[model samples]
Target chain A: MSTTVTQDMSFLYLISSASVLVQLVMLILVLISFFSWWFIFRKLFVIRNEKRKTDDFEDIFWRGVDLNALHQRITSARYDSGSLERIFAAGFGEFNKHPAGSDLDAVMESTRRAMRATYQREMDYLESHLSFLATVGSVSPYIGLLGTVWGIMNSFRSLSSVTQATIAHVAPGIAEALIATAMGLFAAIPAVVAYNRYASSTDQLATRFESFMEELSNVLQRRAAG
Target chain B: MSVSALRNSSYSEPRILLAGALAVLVHLVFIAVLIFGLNWKDQQPEGMMVEIWTELPTPIQESVKTQSPPKQIKPAPEPVKPKPEPERPKPEPVKPEPAKPAPQQAAVTPPVKKPDITIQQKPDPIKEIKPDLERQKKQEQERLKELEKQKELEKKKELEKQKELEKQKELARQKELEKQKELQKQKELAAQQQREQAAKAQREAEAQRAAQQAAARNQITNEISKYKALIQAKIRSRIVMPPDLPGNPIAEFSITLLPGGDILEVRLSRSSGHAVFDNAVERAIHLSKPLPLPPDPALFNEFRNLNITVHYRE
Candidate 1:
């Protein structure tokens, strides 16, 4: 029992002896897991920053800070603005472009257009590569299954020439096959969990940006009317 | 300008490269942990584990010997002492030598003769008791002589009985010897008879075996001929002998057969001078289809090719 179990159950041993196709599958799974982790971390930081900056912008905006002063301060700073800040910046920047005597409807129309464009662009940045995470989570196991199927097929293919087969004869191949699946799950579980978590956070941030846009347009309309 | 910068920062190639490099570092750490941190040796339970399980200390088994009942010890016999103490008075007899020394003074020391007289009186009593002792000793001697004579007579009678018992044993021994000699003669005769019977049985068995072998050989030869005739008969039955074509014709065809007896080829080794007779023989062999073969597969090789001479007249 011990001899058969330890035949190729070692991590390095399994990796080294795995068939080419299963090895490739394992490589792909590891790459997916790693690359997805990268996105997960990057999005984690980006979405957190957006949420923080949006909250900060909302607090100051409600504190009755002068709009022109606020806009100037954000534009002067070299840092990239959050989704909400960028939408506000775009509207304020577009509003400042019009002359004092310009048609109010025409001025508000162009400002809304700028904010809308920035909103979409900012949300696009937040949601970028999220589909890759979803794909990794949803499809990685099947890809791993393909590797397992191929490995088992190879083991059985080698077995056809043999007159008798024991567990020791087939264990290594099966173990290597299961390694693919284990790696796939390792890649997929975090990806799925992160995707669910980050997708929800991004959606929440998008909702906040949309609400801020509506409030900003209303305030700008009052300013233009006066 | 700030908004444009912000939009470009989100999809920056440098950020992706940095993230990918960091991910590579993470994967390396994971691989290292899997390689170095995993204790591979402890995972397997080896043959040594079974040996360790039986390593408990063994208890020594002491053999208990059954004790024998102690013998009743007796006092040992006392050693005998030599009895020569009565000769101690011989030294006192030396006083008579000192009496001889006083011979010159014998007449003058006549008053000292009283001690000599007492000493002389001491031997008188010893002399007087000696007669009684001698008589008692003579009587004891006679009694010993009588007991010795009786023991001698009993010993003579025992010797006579022993002689008689020896004579009877000698007679029985001779009778046993004769009985053994008779039994041995009978055994020898029985062994002789058995030897003769064994020789006769061996000879009969040899003859029967030889006859059986010859019969089996003849049966095999007869069976072979019967089949050969059968094959020849089948082909002959199919033959339309060319009637009245010429002198009595004969055709010999060497036919090749498969294991299933399918005729492979029929070559005329010794063709009849008449072409019609030879053609008729060839046609008959073809019509026979699969020729009859012996049931024995061993005979198949013999039928691989067979030469059968057909007498057209017959």
Candidate 2:
């Protein structure tokens, strides 16, 4: 029994002994899982970085740093600046483009538009591959199920030639087939958890960006009115 | 946003490479853990006792011993053997043949009487010894009579012994004949029983084979019907029926399908009498490319050439 388990139930044996179509399905699922994880890790880094930068910028802005000096410092290091910083710069730059003598309402409107566009772009970046993660999370299990069903069907079909089938005859095929579902769940669970986490965090970041936009627009509004 | 911040929004190539490398490393670690972790633990096996046999057990020995009734029948025939005892008297006539030699003994006795007469004539010459000779002749006659009587008694005893021996021989011959008949009857009975058993087994085998064939045929038909329903459903779903004044017209098609369930040839074997409906059915049959089939390849032969009749109602 020990020998049988070692020989037949090995991971490489199960994957290699699978039918060609089932092997293809497993390969596709593995590649999908790999890419999803890659995206997951990438999103993890990007979102964490964005959140840290947002925290830093919020601290500086609320500390009442001189708006012009902050803007100049951000423009100088624009290449390394975060998403919230970019939104702030866009708003500040647009505010500066219109003279203080211009109609206050028009200047405020243009600044808000500029900030909103920049905020949208940053949100787009944050939310880029969450959909891919979602697609992988939802569809990979079905893909695994497809492989399983096909594998079981093939196994049973082969049994047509056999007059008397025992459990030993069919067990290996089923075990190999079930490996696909196991892999599917393996791939899907992490993707789903990561997707949920990243999606909500991205939503929170968007909310923060929106609130910052609103808050910055009001500050600009007060200055323009004065 | 400024273009430089847009550039920051995009991931650098180095970061993508690092993420990809990390993903590969993580997956490798995960697979390695799966392989090694499962193998590290040893499972305890349940104990089971097994008996090993060098040869198959033969339960037939007792049955074989029981089937042979001839041993018991041998004892039964022993009592019947005594019934042939009345035939024991048949050897009694042979006892008289040994007494035919008594006539030759009588001829020899007449010659002894002539010698006795000569001895009497010589007795007159010797008057002094006449009385003694007469006494001696009388004693000799008596002794001869006793010897003759003893010979007759011995001959009778010998004839009785020969008769008894022949009677026993006759009984043994009768017993032997009866035993031969019994043995032949036993052989015939065993042959008949063996023939009966063989015929019965053959009949049973034929019945079982017929039943299995019937069951296999039923299963095949069931599978074929199931696949037929599937193909019909596919075609029905694909049918873009031409609207007209037709009631429920049935169209029959003789379809030839490849092993993979792809349509090879679709000929309208029996038209619905409406060319439009027939054409529509044919078009639907073709439209449903590679129709659903049973996964079993052995059942595909039954589905290779199908004559399906479609009613244009539902």
* Clashes per model (N, Cα, C within 3 A): 0, 0
* Candidate 1 structure quality by residue, lDDT tens digits, A1-226: 3354453366787788888999999989987888888987777767777788888889989999999998888777636556677788899999889998899989989999999999888777788889999999999998889999999998788776665776666767887798788778877887899899988998898888888888888898898887
lDDT of 1 by residue, B1-314 (tens): 76687566545422556666776787788777666643354255343344445542111101111111111011111110111222223333543454444443443444354457446644654664576576655564555466446545654565565556555655665565567556555655565556556655765686678679989888777777887899999999998877787776788999999988799998999988999889998999999978888788886777788999998776
The native-contact fraction of candidate 2 is 0.25
lDDT (Cα, tens digit) per residue for candidate 2, span A1-226: 3236334456677678889989998999889989988998888888888889899999999999999999999888855688889899989999999966888888989999988888887888889999999999999999999999988988787777676876555666777787788778878988999999999999999999999999999998887776
For each candidate in turn, the TM-score is 0.50, 0.49
Q: Provide the overall lDDT of each model, using Cα atoms, as 2-decimal numbers.
A: 0.73, 0.76
- Candidate number of the best TM-score: 1
For B1-314, candidate 2 gives per-residue lDDT tens digits of: 46445546444422666778888887898788766653443221111111112112223433443454454455445544443343333333333443444444554654575467547644643553465676665565565567556656655665566567656765765675567557655755665566557655765676678679989899889988888899999999888888873688999999999999899999989989988888888999999979888888998888889898988886
Clashing pairs in 2: none
RMSD in angstroms between candidate 2 and the native structure over all alpha carbons: 19.6
Candidate 1 stretches with Cα past 4 Å from truth are A1-8, B9-42, B45-314
Every candidate's DockQ is 0.24, 0.16
Question: For candidate 1 chain A, which ten residues in a row score worst on lDDT?
Answer: A1-10
| Interface RMSD against the true structure, candidate 1 | 3.7
Grade the docking of candidate 2: incorrect
